[model samples]
Target: MAANENKEYSHKFDECPTCDGDLQYQNEADAECLNCGEVFYHEIRANRHLLWDYDELGWMRGVVSRA
Candidate 1:
């Protein structure tokens, strides 16, 4: 088995589960479906590191401090 086989996998939904619309990034932890206007909020992490912080409207905000 590969070294990464036991690691958790993080994925982004290509289509919205609610409406099957194209998912677009609204912010760091939020996404919106273009067709149905459905919004999704989730924290995505990879390689045991935080990829982005959860924010409703943090497009301009800097990196979030975890301390």
Candidate 2:
């Protein structure tokens, strides 16, 4: 994975997208919801800036081309 791509843009999720609550990020690949306890995973593809691709649990929400 191109780790540098992530450094190009610094991002912090303000609230949990699933429950609209607080979020505690374990790392770059993990996001845990403080309210619902839902864990979401994301990937930083090669040469792509997709901040998030799904809502939760495989829900096809958005391909979001950029951060």
Candidate 3:
């Protein structure tokens, strides 16, 4: 471990606030604006680790299909 390795970065955004379009969930941890080319990712926690935000609407489809 290095002394300079201790840092926490935060990206408190998961959607394109500029584009007024529905966010298309690319997977479990990624999303993109269908209208614009803007991209967004999961938020970084206090440990500077990225944790994914899941789409509830998208997950519903998977559950229904598996049934």
Tens-place lDDT per residue, model 3, 27-67, is: 54456777775555543334443433324454312110000
The lDDT values for all models are 0.50, 0.60, 0.43
lDDT for 26 in candidate 1 is 66
- Residue by residue across 1-67, what tens digits does model 2's lDDT show? 4786567435656476656888677887666778988665555556443545455467746643344
Report the lDDT of model 3 for residue 2: 43
Which candidate model has the greater lDDT, 2 or 3?
Answer: 2
Q: Pick the candidate with the highest lDDT.
A: 2
* Candidate 3 residue 32 C-alpha distance from true site, Å: 0.6
Model 2 ranges off by over 4 Å = 1-9, 46-66
In the predicted model 3, the residue pairs found to clash are none
Better of 1 and 2 by TM-score: 2
Q: Give the number of colliding residue pairs in candidate 2.
A: 0
